[model samples]
Target: MPKTCFDPAASMASAALSESTLSGPTMGTRWAVRYQAPPDFDHGALSRDLALTVESVDAQMSPWKPESGLMRLNRSEPGQWVALPADLLGVLARAVQIGALSGGAYDAAIGDLVNAWGFGAVRDAPDPAAIRRAAASHRPAHLWLDIDGERARARKRMPMTLDLCGIAKGYAVDRMAQVMDRHGVAHALAGLDGELRACGARADGRPWAVALESPQEGRRAAHGVIELVDLSVATSGDYRHWIRVGSERLAHTMDGRRAAPVRNPVASVTVLAASCMDADAWATALLVAGPGEGPALAQRMGLDALFLLRCEGRLTEIGLGRFAAHPCRARIAAATPAP
Candidate 1:
């Protein structure tokens, strides 16, 4: 469940651009693409190119799409080699890198557990037995990616599902940004849902100001803010898409280690990475790791991260050293009193 928020107030110069919404299944959720390009940009032509990019990726990678190339491979009886798309192979390789670096805190094979806990395709409360089974099956190490001569194979016969929601959006954003850059749109922002990548300034000389949404339920105030330029930002939190199991509340974020919802003081984590995919994956990883380990990991990885924790019904900002330097002036001013 990813959401996007943009401050159109930040864009200055208005161009004659075409806008359209493209809806489809991505990252186990409905994806709505709101694309804007120059009016002369040829809506049909641009849509065709972008749609083909997305569809080609989905055909080879979507586990939900039964006839997808990945499904074909998953359903293969045994010891069968299914040729993989270059894009899928590239994504899997990066997933492996993140999984290893984060000590398995970030995983691509946690799909079954996510679904069992009412967080994926089937949104129903799962029984203890089902949870246990799903937990046991949530290991990225079990999956194999052998890129040999344009073919990739899963070495093990265990049931596996690859949900790339954590990283796919960022990758797509990056790809779209590249497309725009190639067309000489040096100053534009392209996003899918709120995972965004910005290029140059927004038709002006100022950087994009992103409001960090307060994690408080039903509240719309900015907890903080950050100015971004030529970078991507992704945030993950437990406040949305959660389930109540008895007296305890469970979030959609699953800890691959225990295959259960993470209980941490860190209510939300926002990461500034070179790519939205990296930011997204790191934000999830840090949130699961909790406040202490999260900040430490961010420091080690040289990431700009801000952690928000709810204390006594108030939001507190806890930033790694780097984040403090890039504070959102609006939020800081709001926190200050008039003399």
Candidate 2:
């Protein structure tokens, strides 16, 4: 493990959000907003504004929200074009772009399948035959968006549900960071549910230190740590949000191709990218790709990725060339003994 140091004095206050926060003992779970500007940067107000922006977008886009624009469109007759807000249109375009790049591993139109699997608003044991039928209607290609007019319409009569849970938070983080930057916040870190972006080093020029959580049970220490500046990191793992079906455990992440839970020994995969959306989608895609092919794909795409595998109660890490250059803090201590 390589040791990367972050200055505690410069660490910003973390805001609680949907995911658990384990970066620091007191951090807990929240949407953290840290900025390197005036002490009275109005982060609380900024967070509230960002949350409202997200909520408004959700109201217009989330299929789970019955009153959302998407649901309204779903209920409306065909040939009816629903006017979309600019924000919703932007996110929809991003979703389509990522879906195409990842080969549908990360899809926003899988709301029906997600609901069938009891992962969405409606929770029930889904029938295999029904699952296939629901999945057939969940293709992203069926979605049509006119960015200029901010309008969206589905070509098929099939009920189309859009769930932005996969990429929304990361996109929110980016938006919030923009807000901070506009306020002249030179050094800051915006993170929501482990998807984080570090704008720059602290005022003193110290890089931000981020730790990767161990995927194994009863392991409290970080698997690794990295010093970052102007970078974004996101992790996806089966350890969280999983259900046991018979003797096998299934993760919430589904392979759009097979319409089944990913069966891979890979415990977790973390990615560092230019944006959280890229990192978030790539993390899910790699998890679906499994261990062997996942790392290779990351390399082929010229991405920096770290893979952690659990074998016999221990964690083994495999890093691509780019990720390997970063030192693993935990490993360093094990190799060095006290005098």
Candidate 3:
């Protein structure tokens, strides 16, 4: 018999369950699932289902897709009640809620600003004239977007372009978790891009470990690891997607209030929440809030977040809520063992 990768005693009783992993492309990135399943299980069908799940989300919410449900609403007339898919509507509603809670720091109605800054579908260089217009015309979605849950429709009180880039990916991750549960996979890990959720403990009775990425551009290294058991975590940072303007670097994340890329010393913010959607949005919100009010907001909201701030050319980790109890230390180069 083949040896189980997990503890022998732990797996002896559940010998039918075998460790499995599945991955596919999504949102210009990739999604991965790890789980223990029966040897006879049809993993091929499950993999296809997972791919279709994420593809459905992209079809409904992708700003790059001209025929996506989100873009159709974007092209709709102001004050028009546009019909939207249930998933898109729910995500939009939640995005607005988070935007209000974050004091307009995480608005979903920044599509125009995003495009003007060359981060959206256009992907062109930032246009100064369009940037100024978008800046002057910026409005928070919470104030103008109205949702009719009963009718599965929404209307914009003012003219605005809805962008779910900040929140939809996390929602997709949540959906993937749901798909796993429906498939009767009790212990699984679902992830899209960097957003992740653990369904249960590992086969060895240990939590799934996820790496905390160091906020360094053009380099990939782990700052630490998070042991997750039935929890979700996400990180938002400027390191991954940014454009250099002379000496200034502009991140892809837009600040709706400022109508510009976030300008702060916060290198990144990682948030742990019950749902990946909340984790993803809050991460972006806190990063937009910067180090000052971000910690305060996290305290008030009782959120567990780690803010990696840039100070004197070194990384400083600020923990809130549960993170404060067990602080994660940044790994220094001097401490690394030489290869």
Name the candidate that leads on TM-score: 3
* Candidate 3 local distance difference test against the native: 0.86
TM-score of 2: 0.78
Candidate 2: regions farther than 4 A off:
1-29, 70-80, 124-129, 135-159, 217-221, 326-339
> Candidate 2 — worst ten consecutive residues by lDDT sum?
330-339
For residues 163-253, what per-residue lDDT tens digits would candidate 1 score against the true structure? 6667777777777666666656666666665677667655534556767766755555666566667888888887766888789888888
Model 1 segments more than 4 A misplaced: 1-39, 76-81, 142-159, 328-339
In model 1, the clashing pairs are 4-194
Give candidate 1's whole-model lDDT.
Answer: 0.67
Model 3 off-target regions past 4 Å? 1-16, 326-339
TM-score to native of every candidate shown: 0.81, 0.78, 0.93
Give the winner by TM-score: 1 or 2: 1
Per-residue lDDT of candidate 2, residues 1-339 (tens digit): 334466555443322112111121111235665655554555556656656654564577666667776676556554456665566667667777767766666666666667777676655665677687786765552244223332343322444656666777677667766766765666778787788888776665566777777664434456667666788888898776776667877777777666666777888888888887778778887877887888888888888888877665566677875577655311211211111
Task: Please report how far candidate 3 places residue 334 from its true position, in Å.
Answer: 12
How good is model 3 by TM-score? 0.93
lDDT of 1 at 106: 78
Full-model lDDT for every candidate: 0.67, 0.65, 0.86
